[model samples]
Target: MLIFSKAKLVFLSMPKTGTTAYETALSPFASQYVCDPPELKHAPVYRYNRFFRPMLEKFVSPDIETLAVVREPIDWLGSWYRYRHRPFLAGKPTSTAGMSFDAFVQAYCKGSRPAFANVGSQVNFVKPQPNGTKVDHLFRYENQSGLLTFLEERLGIKIELARENVSPAMPLSLSPEVEEKLRRKCAEEFELWESIT
Candidate 1:
């Protein structure tokens, strides 16, 4: 997560949404940067509300605009599947080695997901808090230019991002049956992604 005090913006890092690249390029300009410890780096709305909001409200500004990026649901899952397939994770319970994309997604659709498919939901990550804290600007991960434009204009700086934390490329094909099950079970993921302008 990156917080700009003067800009009054909090950039929430949604997993697999190219946030690492943003952090790399923009961290120097941010007033506060939380990049260490994956738990804090990817703190969701509820966690931010609990741990960071109060301090920001008191010390920085009470009204901070939150921003986040949501990737297309299937593509997001594919990233996770391919990421875990990296050689470093081979043989680990959380690894996707030797697993087909269809099987990985099917596991994701289960009521109790297996370790390899236990990635968190983007919808829950950006959901509005009880106090009405919500994302003020939400961007699609595919719209990198749009997000960069918004950031440049908002922060008064030229933005340059280098690709980072990319999973290895692989042909990912989900069977229709598994895709249907995923859409049915995770409708909110698609809905949230579609809602972004």
Candidate 2:
């Protein structure tokens, strides 16, 4: 279940799904925000499932609207690759920057992943707000326009996003071998994301 309220909307940040971009664009709307400064950035009443929903509902303004953004598994996985393994960050000779789509697919197939480091664990999933209110808005990262339309229509605000954590610095498609591996590795999540797409 996904949930959000206008008084406090929680961004369940799945790594590399453009959380930074969304946060930047949407900050003006939030009453409080974490990951931003105190002057302009309002802290979350709470960010995660930290407190009971009814308890939060009581405190937050009645008009809060909550939202989240998601992306396709294939592209999302590709971005995860660039974000994690890029050599530029360490300023080394830029070689072996990204894993083969095949190898990355194989690694993702393993069920368990470390909390923040692994691909599937950080992404490929969504977490619900406490007490499980259905999400008011779900945006598709693959279709930024669609997401923007959704938010504008519902929230009555126009948003322009400058995306950080951008991936596919050089846009590359997955090979057939890699595609099949991905299809096989993330069957369940692929199906779900496909439906969303």
Candidate 3:
């Protein structure tokens, strides 16, 4: 949620938005502190990143350019479920582990348990940008071409990311009702999908 200008760049990683891929692609133009996004800790990445931003700014010449990719809530949530339910966490609960996506969403909205352990909550991307609008450039996941152009033009880095993230149909097992509910409830999140993916 930050846009950097005349400063170093840093990608404030959002979960599963091809953040890992972007980290690798943008590494050459950034500082050596480039690390991947952390795990489920209830706080947004911007908060933690911003807390360290001052130290980074005082110690370094220019602050890191902040960047992150966002995905649609429905697509993001579905993909998140599939991503967590992969072979590694097959035995573990998925985004819809204990209940259907709708049920989990109901609980989440009502202050019950969370659906997924990752970026499943609305708070993940709901917070304000930590560095205001001076964090440099941010790229959209759906706007792949534009993103590439921005990186090349701004960071002078050219790279390729996998073409596997975007799709029309979400992963199976989720009912249409559940999908619709999640989408409506997370309209803001869906709005950021094109920006985050």
TM-scores for all candidates: the values are 0.98, 0.69, 0.68
TM-score, cand. 1 vs. native: 0.98
lDDT by residue for model 1 (1-197), tens? 99999999999999999999999999999999998799999999999999999999899989888899999999999999999999999989999999899999999999899999999999999999988988889999999999999999999999988989999999999998999999999999999988877
How do the candidates rank by TM-score, highest first? 1, 2, 3
Error of model 2, residue 50, in angstroms: 3.9
Tell me how candidate 2 scores on lDDT: 0.56
Candidate 2 stretches greater than 4 Å from native: 1-9, 36-47, 52-55, 61-65, 88-98, 112-117, 121-124, 127-134, 171-173
Deviation in Å, model 1, residue 151 alpha carbon: 0.4
Which of candidates 1 and 3 reaches a greater lDDT? 1
Tell me how candidate 1 scores on lDDT: 0.94
* Candidate maximizing TM-score: 1
Writing each residue's lDDT as its tens digit, candidate 3 over 16-132 gives 566666655555545553353344222245564556556656676454555556555555565655564444454554434444555544544343444353345434544556346
Comparing 1 and 2 on TM-score, the stronger one: 1
For model 2, how does the per-residue alpha-carbon lDDT over 40-66 read when each residue is reduced to its tens digit?
222222333344345556786544455
Ranked by lDDT, top first: 1, 2, 3
Per-candidate alpha-carbon RMSD to the true structure = 0.7, 5.5, 5.0
